[model samples]
Target: MTSPPRPEPRSRAAGGPDIVPVSPNPYRFRTGRVVLVLEGVLLLVLGVWGLAAAGEGTAPPAGAAVGPLQLTTAHAALLLGTGVLAVGCSVRRRSALAVVTAQAVGYAVLFLVGLVGAAHEVPTVLGFDYGDAVLHGGLMVIGLGLGMWMAGEGLEGLWWERRRRASRSDDHHRSGTSRSPS
Candidate 1:
C-alpha cells in the first residue's frame, strides 16, 4: 500500500502553529565594532604622538601639542581598552552590553581628563596651550557621543533578543492547545 502523505508544516498565522522565526537585524553588531575600532585607532595615534612629543622635550607644532606623557597614558588606556572590548563583543556575538559598558566608561574617563587638562592648563612635556586644550575638549565630546551610541546599540540588541524570545513563547503556547474552540 502507498504511504499517506506527510502533513505540511503549519505557520504561526494559521490555525495550526509553529515557532516563528525572527527576522535578522539589518544592522549587524559589526557596524558598532567598526566605529569602536576607528575611535580606538584615533586615540592610539593621538596617544603615541603625545608621548613622542613629551620625549622630544620640544613643543609640538601648533594645534598638535597634546600635553604630557601623563595625559597620553590616559588616552592610550582608553583606546586600548575600547578596542579590546569591541573586538571581544564581535567575537562573542552575544556580549554587546559588556562592550558598550566598557566603551562608555572609557569615554567618560577620557572626557574628564580632557576637561582637567583644559581647565588647569596642565602643560604637556611639549608645552600645551589654550588651542591644544580646546582641541582635546572637542575630541573628547565627540568620543563621548560615539560611546553613548555604542551603548544604545547594545541595548537595542538586547531588546531584539527579548522580543524574539517572547514571540517563540507565544507560538509554543498556541501550538500546545489540542484543538481550536471555533
Candidate 2:
C-alpha cells in the first residue's frame, strides 16, 4: 500500500519555511573536546622541544625555551604524559569530563608546590620556575573551568538518566503489565 506524503511546515501568510530557533549552547558538547585536543597538541609540542633541548645540552640553568614557554626535563615529562592522556580521553565518548577534572587537580597541586618551593628556596622535583608556576596556574584554571562547564552541560545527567531509567523499568515490572505475543 502507498502512503500519502507529509506536508512541509511553513508560515501561512508568508508561504515560506518557518524559522527554527537555535539553542544557545549549540556547541556545548564540542567545545570542551576541541579545547582538550588543542591543549594536548600544544603540550606535546612543548614536551618534545624541552626533551630535545635537554638531550642536546642546550637547556640553561633556569630552563629551556620550548616555544615561548620555559620547561625543564621534569616539566617536559609531566606535559608529555598529561598531553597523551588528554588526547586519548578527548577521543572517547564520555571520558573528557573526568580527565579534564583530574588534570585540573594535578595542575593545581603542581602550582602550589612550585609556589612553596620558590618561596622557601627549596629545590622542586619538577624544576618549576616562576614562569612554570604561572603556566600551571593558567592550565589549572582552564581545565577546571572546562570541567565545570561540561558538568553544567549535563554530564551528571548521564548518571542520573541511567538511574531514572532503571527505576522506571522496575516500576513498570511491579505494575504486572504483560503483553500478549502476536
Candidate 3:
C-alpha cells in the first residue's frame, strides 16, 4: 500500500517565490558583486581625477596619444559612467567578465602603444607617474587572470544549480506527484 512520489520543481517549487537563487554557494554572487562595485568606484575616482587635471597646460583635451593609443578626459568620464552602470547591473547580471575584459583591453592598448616596439614619452596615467610601460602590462595580466577566475567560478556555480534543480525534478517525478512549473 505504498504511495507514489512527486516531481520536484525546476528553478522553483510550485507556488514558490518568483526569484530563486541559482547557486549552492551564495558567496559566488557576492564576490562578483563586491568586485564589480569596487572596480566601478576606482574607475569613477580616476575619471574625476582626470577631469580635475584638465586645466593649466594639461595634456590637451583629446588626451595624450602614444602611437596608436588615445586617452581623454571625456574617455575617463565615459569609463566612469560605464563602471557605475556595471556596478548597478551586477546586482542581477554577471559583470566580472565584462568589466575585467574591458580593463584588460585598455591595458593591452596601453602596452601596445608604449611598450611594444619603440617607447613613447608621455609617462603618466591619471596624472600619476607610470615609470615604465610595465605597469600596463601587469594590470592587463591581472585583469585577464581575474576575468578567467570569475567566469569559471560563476559558471561552475550555475552548472551545480542546474544539476540540483534537475535532481529535484527527478525526485518529484519519481514520487508520482505532478511536476511543478518552473
Candidate 4:
C-alpha cells in the first residue's frame, strides 16, 4: 500500500495565521479562588471565636463540656495558621499546589484536634462527643477533596495551554506561512 503524504510544518510567526490560542477557562480558576477565599475567611472567623471561647469560664448545664474554654488555644492557632497560609498563597498567585497543601494541613489539624478532644473528654461549651468528632472529621475530608480537585484543575489548565499552543503551531505550518523569529 502507498504511504500517506507527510503534512507540511506550520509557520513560526507570533501572529501566524495557523496560531489560534484557545482561551483559558476562567470559571474553574475563579471558582477555586473564591472557594479558597471563603474557606480562609471562615477559618479566620472560627479562630477568633475559639480564642474568645478560650477565655470564657462558664460550663453548660447539659452534657459534659470537653475541657476548659482556654483549651481551645491550640485549635485557634491551627485555624489561624491555615487561614493565613491560604490567603497568602492566593495573594501571591502561587501554584494550586500551595493552596491544596495549605488546605490539607488545615483540615488535618482540625480533624486531629477534634479526635483528641473527643477521646480525652475535654469539655468545651460545645461539649466534646462522638457526634462532634464525626462532624469535624467529615468537614476535613470534604475540604481535602476540594483541595485535590483544585490542584487537578490547575494541571488541566497547564495541559490545555500547551495543547492550544501546539495546535496553533500546526495550523501555521499547514497554511504554508512563514513564522516570525522569536
Error of 3 at 22 (Å): 6.2
For candidate 4, what is the TM-score? 0.55
What are the Cα lDDT values of the candidates?
0.49, 0.73, 0.56, 0.56
Over 1-182, each residue of candidate 1 has an lDDT whose tens digit, in order, gives 44345344455567654643332543544565576566556656665665565456563332234543343343444444555555455444336445555455644554565556556544543233445445445545654565455455334532212213456657768889444568
Stretches of candidate 3 off by over 4 Å are 1-24, 56-75, 78-82, 116-118, 121-135, 153-182
What C-alpha RMSD separates each model from the true structure? Answer: 13.3, 15.8, 12.3, 11.4
Tens digits of per-residue lDDT for model 4, 113-171: 66676676446544445555664565477567656655553456422222235577788
- What stretches of model 4 exceed 4 Å from their correct place? 1-17, 20-24, 56-71, 92-96, 109-113, 122-135, 157-182
- Clash count list over all predictions: 2, 0, 10, 18
Q: Which window of ten consecutive residues has the lowest lDDT sum in model 3?
A: 123-132
Q: Tens digits of per-residue lDDT for model 3 on 6-99?
A: 3343444555533433444556556766766776676666556655554334566345443333445655565567567656666654455666
Report the candidate with higher TM-score, 1 versus 4: 4
Better of 3 and 4 by TM-score: 4
Best by TM-score: 2
Q: What is the TM-score of each candidate against the true structure?
A: 0.47, 0.66, 0.51, 0.55
Error of 4 at 84 (Å): 2.5
